[model samples]
Target: MRLDDLPLPDTPAARAALEVARRFHSPAFVNHGVRSYLWAAAAARSEGLAVDDELLFVSAALHDLGLEPAFDSHTLPFEEAGGLVAWVFAAGAGWTEERRDRAAAIIVAHMADAVDPAVDAEGYLLEIATALDISGRNPEAWDAEFRAEVLEAYPRLDLVGEFTGCIVDQAERKPGSTAAAAVAAGLPARLAANPLQL
Candidate 1:
């Protein structure tokens, strides 16, 4: 799917999520959030997965919020902390309790090695999208032209350096967290090797 063809939701909740991301994140992170959603939506279109666009967009926007000082958790992993933040945001947006839970679930699930699309399509898409954005995993899945469009719309900026510092800090603080696992698995090398670097 073309980047333009995947319409970004125009709902109040969607706008609010973008606002929150911009307020809390650096330009690199804000762009990462938006790009993650676009990549996921594009993949969903190609795979014929039925997804809630609002849910995916909101999840993508706030997935890394826990990395920010304002919302960073002392005890919980970053993703878990971010999930709680999403839950509260959904409540303020007047989403149902079930929907709020699902949003939070999607945020947390993005840290998983893999999420089954049949069970939680939004979560699965977010996982795949973030991996693509962060580590350049499966970049070839998206055509070159669409990738260029996405980068043009939301440039990568300094995501590699910014993300590395946040993730490394998370790994040091929470030794058992997914961030730690990723660090141990050579995330720095992967980030350096990411083909999306511009």
Candidate 2:
């Protein structure tokens, strides 16, 4: 699906999520998420992952929303992105505490290379987001040099099953079985869905 084809929220919560995302994301990253989501949806459809287009679109759009205030520069390799933009965005989207927190975990734990276990629902989405992020060019406002420097911080990633599952779960109407399980069962699907041709 194209960016215009991706789901746009009619609800206040989803709208808020978009507003929150616009603050920190460069147009390129934002565009990448749309393309990635479309690819991810296609992968899920082919794999029988049973995820919906809206959930997939919304989740992908907000996946990186958790970048911290410090995200402005590449001084820090990665920040606690899980909660950075997620907390506020989820709230705008009117997600449940459980759901919002689960979303937050993805933002905070997004740094795949830095994460100890490096396998969880949130981390899984982050991995896909990051891969797709650097794969394309970012907007000038984001600073090309800073984006490249930050991209270098992430080394070869070792994906966990649980992380990938989160994408599946979120795409599904079930919205992932308690965040923890998202990565557990969704990794293979997530890895398969990655459109970077990795």
Candidate 3:
């Protein structure tokens, strides 16, 4: 789906985020990211959670908007920039302190090697989100074993699995304006090209 069609805030944070996306980014990341949000929305509804589709969508939008100038070149990740975008969103969108804190916590824990006890934070949500987006055909494929391993740590495996499969299936079919149809179209093949193994 087009970014415009996403439910994210149409405020400064959203505008600033689009400006950043225009600089340098991956179409695969964007497409799958949207696809992921769709699944997450489903999962949220299944839980009777009132996740702001727009808020979650905005969070997903800026999930990795901080890539290097070369788009995928740098290793450090635009961490500070990611925070800035989140800050902008919290302020511009008038989010509650709990919500802002949740986003900040999630972003901070996202890249950590170990899951913390304090939260069912962003890292966990993002894993579910990103997995829903890109866990293409053969999720049983060895290449994605690490993700499977990680999912094992979640309290909602069966639920995540349900929507994740849907994400892969949807990604395979072409329906609307994706970031680059060809990119996600090639994902299953690329994922199938190699299996993950520990």
Q: Model 1 over residues 136-157: C-alpha lDDT tens digits?
A: 8999999899999999999999
Worst 10 residues of 3 by lDDT: 151-160
Q: Could you report the Cα RMSD, in angstroms, for every candidate shown?
A: 0.7, 13.7, 13.2
Report lDDT per candidate: 0.95, 0.44, 0.46
Q: What is the lDDT of residue 132 in candidate 3?
A: 38
Against the hidden true structure, what lDDT does model 1 obtain?
0.95
Top lDDT model: 1
TM-score of 2: 0.47
- Per-model TM-score, in order, reads 0.98, 0.47, 0.47
Superposed Cα deviation of residue 35, candidate 2 (Å): 2.4
Which of 1 and 3 is the better model by lDDT?
1
State the RMSD for candidate 1: 0.7
